[model samples]
Target: MSMARTVSDTRLIFGRYLRQTLRSKVAVVFGLTQPLLYLLLFGPLLTRLGGVRGFGSGDAWQVFVPGVLVQLALFGAAFVGFGLIGDLRSGVVERLRVTPVSRTALLLGRVLRDTVVLVAQAVVLLGAAFALGLRAPAAGVAVGLLFVVGLAVSVASLSYVLAMRTRSEDAFAPLLSAVTLPLMLLSGILLPMGLAPGWLDAVSRCTPFRYVVDAARAAFRGDYATAAVGEGALVTVVLLVVSVALGARRFRAENA
Candidate 1:
C-alpha cells in the first residue's frame, strides 16, 4: 500500500475509536482517579521524607509526580489489551480483517488512540500535582510527557499483540497481572529505588522502566543533560521500535 493510503487508513481508524472514547466522558475523567488518589493520599507522605537522599534533588512532589506520571502510563497503557480482547470476542477484529485498511494502520490507529488518551491523563495528573504543590520546569514536564507517550506506544502495541494471541479475557487478565505487578514494583513508580535495599536496587536497574523513571525525575529536577535522560530515551526508542514491529507483524498475519 502507498504511504499516503496507509496514513489515511490510520487516520480513519483513529477517528472511529477516538469518537467512541470521547462519547464516554466519564471514562476519560475516571481514568485519572488512580493517579490522583496517589497524589492526594500517598504524595503527602513523601513530603516528610523530603530530606531523605535518593529521592532526587527536588521537593517530594518533584521526585514523586514524575513517578506517578510514569505509573499512570505504565498501568494505564498496560491493560489496554482488555479492550482489544473485547473487540475480538465481539467480532470487531473479524470485521476489520476483511477491510482494505493497511494492516499496519490497523495496529497504529489503535495504539495512537491509546497514546492520546494516556497523554491527556498525564496532563490532568500533572495539573493536580501542581495544585498540590508539585513544581517543575515546564520544559522538563514536557520532556517527561514525551516519555509518557513513548512508553504508552510501546506497552499498548505489545498489549494488542498479546490480546490477539490469547483471545480470551480470562487467560489474558491473570497473565497480564502477573507480568505488570513485578514491572510496577521494580520500576520504582511509587518510591525511588534508591530507597530499596542494595540487592533490590541492583535488580531494579535491570528493568528498563528504572531508567525511564530515573530520567523523568532528573527532567523534573530540570537537569536534562544527565545520563539518566539519555538512557531512558534510548530504551524508549528501542522498545517502541521492537514492540511496534511485532504488533504490525501480528496484525498482518491475522488479517492475511
Candidate 2:
C-alpha cells in the first residue's frame, strides 16, 4: 500500500512536469542540438583521424557514438539540480512541501522527468549517429538506451540532493563542474582511456563512469554477455540505489 501510494504520487507529479515540457517545444529541439552538432562536426573528423593511435577499430562512429551518448547523459543529467534550485528560490518546493505526497515521489518524479527527456535526446542522438555511419545491432542500441536511463536516474537524483543542500545555482555550478570535469576527462568519453599515459589509465579505473562507457562500447560491438556489461550493470544498480536513497532522505528532511 505504501509503495502503491508513492507510485501514484509520482505519476501525478511526473504528469505535471511532462505537461510543462510539452508546452515548450523549443526546449525539446535545443536540448538535442549539442549532441547533434557533435555527431555532424566532430564525428567525421574522428573518422578522418581513425589512423591515430587512440582510435579503436576504425569504425569511428561506432566508437564515437557510444561515448557521445554517454556524454549526453553525463553532462545533461548531472545539472538537473538547477531546476530544483529554481523551484526552491521561487517557493515552488515549499508549496509542495505542505502536500501529502511521498517525499520519495517528489524526487523520483523530477528524476523520472529528467530520464524521459534524456531518453528522447538519446533517441535523436542515435538517429543522427546512424545516419553518420554507426552500425550497431538494434539490441545494442536498445541496451544503450537502457543504460542511459539508468544513468539518468542516478545522476539526476544526486543532482537534486545537491540542489537541496546548496540551495543556490551559483554554488552548485562550480561544485558540479569540479566533479563533472574530472569524470569526463578520466572516463574516456571522447577517447578511450587505454591511450592515456599508464598512470592516467590506471587512475581512470577508479571512476564508475569509465565502466559505463566501456559497457556501452561493448554493447555497441554486440557483446552483451561480456564481463564489462555485468560490471557496468552492477555499478549502475549500486549508484541508483545510493543516489535515490540520499535524494529521498534529503527530500524527507526538507519536508520535515
Candidate 3:
C-alpha cells in the first residue's frame, strides 16, 4: 500500500509539472522548435558534405541523427535545477526540509520530469530525422529509450550539482553554456571523429558523449556498439555519483 501511494503521489506531482509546463506555450514551442529546425535544415545539408572515412559512411546526415537527438535531449538539463532554485529563493525548500518526504525522491522527481521532457524532444527530433530519410527500424525504439535515459541521467545529475551550489539563474547561464557546448561539439553531432582533426578526435573519444553517440548510432544501424555502450554507462554512473554527492554536501552546508 505504501508503495502504491508513493507511485500515485509521484504521478500526481509529475502530472502537475507537465500541466504547468505546457501552459507556458511560448516556452514549449521554443524548447522544441530549434531542434526540429536543425534536423530539417541541416540533416540533408550535412549528409551532402560526406561522412568522415573513419565514420564508415558517405551519408553524414544518416550517421548524425541518433547522436544529435541524444545530444539535444541534454538541452533541458540546464534548466532542470531552476525549480530548486525557485524553491530556495521562495523558502519552499525550507518547508520541505521539515517534512517526511524522501530527499532522494525530491531530486528523483525532478530528474524524472526532465527525462520525460528530454525524451519527448528526442522522439520528435528523431522522428523528423526519419522523415528526412534517416532510417530507424522498429526495434530501434528499445535502444532509443536506453540512449535517452542515459543522456537524461547524466544531464539531470549535472543540474543537481549546479542547483545545490548556485542560486541565481543568471549565474547559471555561462556555466550551462560551457557545460553543453563542449559536449555538443565533442559528441560528434555536427562532426564525427573521422571528420574531426586528430587532436580533436582524441579529446572527443575521452568524452562520454562520444560513447553515447557511437552507441546510439550503432543501435539505429541495427548493430550495437557494445564497447561504447558500456563506456557511456560507466561514465554516466560516475558522473551521477559525483553530482549526487556534491549536491548532498552543498545542500547540507547551505542549510546549516
Best by TM-score: 1
User: How would you encode candidate 1's per-residue C-alpha lDDT over 205-236 as one tens digit per residue?
Assistant: 98888888888889988999999999999998
Model 2 lDDT tens row, 79-136: 8889889889999898888878888888888888888889888987888788778999
Models 1 onward score TM values of 0.97, 0.94, 0.85
Model 2 earns a TM-score of 0.94
For candidate 2, give the lDDT of residue 154.
90
Tens-place lDDT per residue, model 3, 1-256, is: 1656546555655676677667775775677787787777777677766633676542565467776676666776666777777778988777765665445445655666777777777777767776777766667656756776766776776786687677788887678888888888888876667677899989998877777777666666666546766676676667667766655455445361
TM-score of 3: 0.85
Candidates arranged by lDDT, highest first: 1, 2, 3
Better of 1 and 3 by lDDT: 1
Error of 2 at 222 (Å): 0.4
